[model samples]
Target chain A: MRPFEYASPNSKEQVAALLGTSWEQGAILAGGTDLLALMKDDVVTPRRLVNVKGIDTLRGTSYQPGNGLRIGALTTIAELADSKDLAQYPMLFEAVTEAASPQIRNLATIGGNMCQRPRCWYFRSGMGLMPMTKDGKSLVVAGDNRYAAILGTQTGAYFVSPSTIAPALIAYGAKVRIYSAKASGSGVRELPLGRFFITPKSAKEREHDLKPDEMVIELIVPPPPQNLKTGYFEVRQKAAFDWPLAMAAVALQMDGNTVKSARVVMGHVAPVPWVSDEAAATLVGKTITPDTAMAAANAAVTKAKPLSMNKYKITLAKAAVKRAVLKAGGAA
Target chain B: MADDRPRKPEDNSGVTRRDFMKVSAVGVAVPVVLGSVMDAAAEEVPIQGPGKVPITLQVNGKKLSAQLEPRVTLLDALRDNFDLTGAKRVCDRGACGACTVLMDGKPVYACAILAIDAQGRMITTIEALAEGDSLSPVMQAFVAHDAQQCGFCTPGFIVTTTNFLQKQPAPTAEEIRHGLSGNFCRCGTYDGIRAVALAHAGGKQS
Candidate 1:
């Protein structure tokens, strides 16, 4: 780790100022679970580290009935997993718990997890193994792409977004509050989780629409629908601290025994949280029987473009989606 | 009671002409010396530069303050500067809980936390588990059960078990497993560890 100046700012304004100063010089230090690893791996070398934990306003979990839950940016994953409010939002709790081991969760912040970099081995290893083009060639077209990506291939970067909470939040209809340095007042933009992600082809920018200097101050999850049932399911090799191979977050608005509306999102298969409105639309006005659930899951994966080694991910993703939908629908 | 005696400057040996010639030769090799000094300085640079960041931390029953960098991990600050080595460092990554410490009464991986982030929290480490020369009841139970083999992971287990006991002194076997799962024992002392935890939880100890 290179020597860097340290600052423990007391307010979000100070934090934004530090970040707005220069991207090349400063990096925000939240939980340090991911940032420290990146620093150790030499992936990012910032000249100054601005610690945000000292800010009193960036730390708690609040809930209001008929309104929503507002989680501070510095709230730890362990806190979220053990939150009482999360009992009303089981999908959020389950996603937070399934993210990493207890030790990792103890120190990983929710904001940091949402804004973490991709878990591409090539990116971490700094080997330039990602499909880069001298003129226009997909280098990862033939290499080890077992965990690359099954969607968003045209833009050439095939890395999975390793955030478990993002999919669940998206499924629950959460919005982010971003704070910028230059702005007189912080800007609050509310977008459904489905619209939060943009592929490289769709928008050649980064995963989330957060600017370089803006910080995610808090996440607000609107009150769930009266008849909505939500659940999250992830498939992994072992209980080891690796990202999920395939995951699904399902939220269904059921009318009696029939589904009225549904939100089914697949994770780790695309560059961002892949929301399947097509699959969701197929479930409305239909009974959530095994056949209906299977059809929805199959419909979700029809447009999936699997890489060579990651073809297994398509089956795994379908199974996850099916299980999550069944579980959320209370059929399992 | 003072026996005041002035020391004489004459007792010191004066510089020799040969030493002066040696110093002159070293001056001629100044570029190489300066280059090596600069290289050493670069390598010795601290990860977080020096500054007295005001942090109010309540550890155990006392409040303490220490100058630390934003990048200095809680594990490093505690072990290196504060001399509290009860928390071990096995896999510096959060994989192993050898550096588990409680913040605001909840267990957290010390190695994964930045010292600056832990400000204004009540931190409890393994060092606080003893009273005078006597070990805490949980520690005594661990010793009686022979739970520790090499003792590398003992501090983390002790701290984690202490926190768990604080929450639920009488935990079920499943709860014990879940609570201690954050820690790793390279020596496979899990059976004994479980026995110690159960014994303590069963009112055999505190």
Candidate 2:
């Protein structure tokens, strides 16, 4: 990695101030898991690194009765996986544990995970976010795109979202709390976690909604319904430390044997965590059975327009959805 | 606003416009002074460098000072500067656990951690696992079960396993396998490693 100026800020505002308003000037150094790799690969070379680890306030996970679960951005993946408070939301627990190796989980934070760059080889090989040829021909559309996005390909962005916990968080109705120097008053802003992800229209923009000057300080998950049941399932080639091929998270509000409401989110098969309203609609007011869950799973992937090499992802995604829905409904 | 809520420390000591623009000296469309803390005193933190900067690390019960750039990883610092080469550097990324070290009693990849960022944490490397003349229990098990072949990944495995046993002294067979998933052995010494881990777990061995 190239030499860079380091700033250890004690507060979120200082970090934002140091990071200016553009990606060229500085980058936030949260866990150093993804950022270090990007720097080493010369994918992103910021002149200054704003280390936010010194901000003591943004560190752990806690839950309040009325306010719900408030997880500090600096909480490590291992910390989240082992948090007793997360036991109530088993979908989140399952998703986190299925992430990278234990060693990585010890250092990788939830905030960094939220903003991690796409893991597309094209992107990693210094090809801009949207890889193009000399004459401006798209590389990922015809090239090796087995892991490219199946759902949001209508947008130019093709790389799959690398976050394992995003689907689960989105399913649980989580909100991301961002601290920006430009924000009015207290400089804090909260948006639904699903809205945090975006498909960049150009190479200069990021895949997430966060500005260069903003930092994700915390994640707030509202209290679940009284009869809430959630399940998360990921299909990977190996059981070891590897990214999932396809995954799904299912959250159901059950009225005894019937479903009152549902949220189904898919991961690793889209540019963003794909929330399927059709799948949710199929589950509402219907009793969850093997056939009904499979139908919902089928509806979840109905709109997946896979690239040449990724048609297999549609099958895996359907399996993931069926398994997650069944597990949430207590049918499996 | 909650009337009883404590006021932020930065509220009393206001951040000047000069400081904000001075720190962020780029194409900043909007410049605004901002600073706050939950409880820590509002003290100005000096920015360290692109060049070498002095930093002290708490490693293996010792305070070791070194002049290192911000980009220097903890693995490089431990091996090159401190001469603690027990933590190998295979697959410099966090994927392979060759450079595993215990940071604040948690096993973390030293290769993925910046030396400057590892300041206050208590880092325990493979060298610190043994007590003088005697090897640690996990090391003894590795020897007894012949759990190594090329021995390249042994230090990291030993460090990780020792920490794992500390947390779960009697882990099940599946737990042991899951615990050691971070480290990879190309020589396929997994059977021996599993045997050693099982033997170490004593009566609970499956």
Candidate 3:
């Protein structure tokens, strides 16, 4: 890592002031799991590191019947996995547990998880950042794109969403609180987590909607619907700690044996956590049988335009959808 | 690539490891601020540095002081300056747990932790695991079970096992395997490692 200034601010505002107007001048060191790796690889060379772990308010996870679940942005992934409050949210627990190794989870925070860059080898491998472009063209379009985006590959960007928990959080109707030095009045913005991320515009663009000076302060999960069923499933080449090739998060609002509403989101197949409204619509007003599950699964990948080498992801995504819905419906 | 290209450290689209537990299970309230519990009369003297900064850390029950650049990682400071070679640097990233150490009673990758950033926490490394010429029970169990091949990974496994057993004294064989997934053994010595953990689990099963 390059030599950089370090500051452990006591308050969120202090961190904001130190960060100034751009994180390119300074990077917030939350868990150091992602930031350090980015630094070590020479991908990001922020001259100052503002340690936000010392900020008091941005910590802990709590839930209320009326107010819903509020998880501090600094809450570690391990804590999310082990929280007794999350015992009923199997979709969430599965996403957390299936993320990184236990040791990495101990050092990773949900805020950092939200700030992930793309895992495209071309983007990460070369010393120069955003290596997917050369001579004003995308190298990924013609190169090895097996791990690239399948849904949002129309643009020059091809990196898939690397977050395992993002789809689950979106399925559960979670919202994120963004604290920025640039925001008005309270210096905060509370928005749905589903709209939190963006597909890469160019290879070098920030993947999320967060501004350069913004810091994710907390994640709020609203109270789930009555008679709710949720499940998360990931298809990984290696069961140990590998990133899922494709995955799905399914949550169904059931009216006894029939579905009243549904939320189905796919991961690793799109630029952002890919929500399929078509898939969700297929489950409404129908009993969660094998036929319904397969129909919903097929609908989930109906619009997935696979890259030259990524047709296999379409199949994996369908399986993930089917399995997640079945598991959520309690029919499997 | 253009020579005039702006130096952009593109994003790290996060990461994934290969250490999930098949059947295994499993912070206290850490006060968020370094000076939160301090005397109120003290001035709010903020310390910011991009250069060599002096820091005092309580490592293995001793207050050790060092002047290091903010970018220097805890793993490098321990192995380079302090000469604490017990924690080896394998995957300098957080992927491999070779440099695992107990930071505030939790096992974290030392290489990923910046030296300046880890100052206020209670950092424990592998060097403090035993008395003079006396191995800890966890270490003894490893030896008894012959749970090593190259021994390059032994110190990490020992430190990690100590941390794991403290939390789960009665882990099953599968739990033991899953718990030790962070530390990679290239020699395929997982069977023996599992045996050592089960032998020392104090006969509790679930």
Number of the top candidate by lDDT? 2
Scored by TM-score, the top model is 2
Once fitted onto the true fold, the runs of candidate 3 whose alpha carbons sit more than 4 angstroms away are: A126-130, B1-47, B202-206
| Per-prediction TM-score, chain B alone | 0.70, 0.79, 0.74
TM per candidate = 0.81, 0.92, 0.89
lDDT of 1 by residue, A153-266 (tens): 667768887898899999888987777644554444555655656665422356666665677788889888788998688998856455799999999988998888899988
lDDT, candidate 2, A1-332, per-residue tens: 87776778886766766776678678999998999989989999887789998888999999876777889999999999989888678889888887888898889999999999989999998887888878776798879988888898776788989998999999999999998865788889899999999988877777899887889999999988789999888999978688899999999999988999999999998889999999999999999899999999899989989888999999999999999999998878
lDDT of 3 by residue, B6-54 (tens): 3223311111121111001010122436345322212231434455667
Model 1 has a DockQ score of 0.15
TM-score of chain A of each: 0.94, 0.98, 0.96
Which runs of model 2 end up more than 4 angstroms from their true locations?
Answer: B1-21, B24-43, B203-206
- Which 10-residue window of candidate 1 chain A scores lowest in summed lDDT? A196-205
Whichever of 1 and 3 has more lDDT, that candidate is 3
Q: By lDDT, is 2 or 3 better? A: 2
- lDDT-wise, the better of 1 and 2 is 2
Q: What is the interface root-mean-square deviation of candidate 2?
A: 8.8
**Which has the higher DockQ value, candidate number 1 or candidate number 2?**
2
CAPRI quality level assigned to candidate 3 from its DockQ score = acceptable
Global fold similarity of model 3 (TM-score):
0.89
Please say which candidate is ahead in TM-score: 1 or 3. 3
lDDT of 2 by residue, B47-90 (tens): 56666778799999999998788789999999999999999999
Query: Which should have the higher TM-score, number 1 or number 2?
Result: 2
